[model samples]
Target: MSLKGVELQIAIPKTFDAGKMADQHHQKTINQQLDANEALNREIERKQLAVNKSEGMDAISEEDENDASNNGQTSSEQNKKKKQQQEQDAQHPFKGNLFDFSG
Candidate 1:
């Protein structure tokens, strides 16, 4: 096959440098994305805080309603009532012995 038929090819590498205009555009895009993400995060945090506050308020209101229904009795009065009930139960023991082994 002599040198009568031959072919040559070459590949040129592209420039990787981004000019000032392209760099500015890229930076603007990045800043916009960051701002949008920050806003979204703030909104999420606000909603979470609102939910927490509402839940706390609901718990407080429920406790208040319970106290109101109990004739405004304080925790001490409720505790005394519970102790009295327990003492009464103890005074009246079970009729049948739980340890009875007879068939």
Candidate 2:
């Protein structure tokens, strides 16, 4: 038997395009990353707004305390306390000269 004049033929199924699949996967990841970043930004903005509101409240409370203090004490008493504190500070010349964390 001679097969010199016969040629063999095989049909293969179509394969997926690896490059297209990779591109699609990359796009999905990028979108997910962008969504995460946006969510983080929103959270940060919310936290900053809360901090600002709290800071405003703190300032109001501090003002109230100042008004209360001013109303509660005489001006001479306040001046006397200030003089005493100044004298105490003068007595402590070596205060804050060294850092101690021995607690």
**Top-lDDT structure, candidate number:** 2
Which residue segments of model 1 deviate by more than 4 Å? 1-18, 52-103
The alpha-carbon lDDT assigned to residue 89 of candidate 1 equals 57
| lDDT (Cα, tens digit) per residue for candidate 1, span 1-103 | 3332222122112222346568889999999999999999999998877745457787678757766788867889977876886686577465554766696
Clash totals, every prediction: 0, 0
* Per-residue C-alpha lDDT of model 2 across residues 1-103, encoded as one tens digit per residue: 5334232222121124566678899999999999999999999998877744456787678757765778878889877876886687588667768867797
Score residue 55 of candidate 2 by CA lDDT.
68
Cα-based RMSD of candidate 2? 8.1
Q: Please give the lDDT score for candidate 2.
A: 0.72
What's the distance in Å from true for residue 11, model 1? 22
Candidates' RMSD to native: 10.8, 8.1
User: Stretches of candidate 2 above 4 Å error?
Assistant: 1-16, 52-73, 79-103
Query: Local error of candidate 1 at 97, Å?
Result: 48
Prediction 2 TM-score vs. true: 0.43
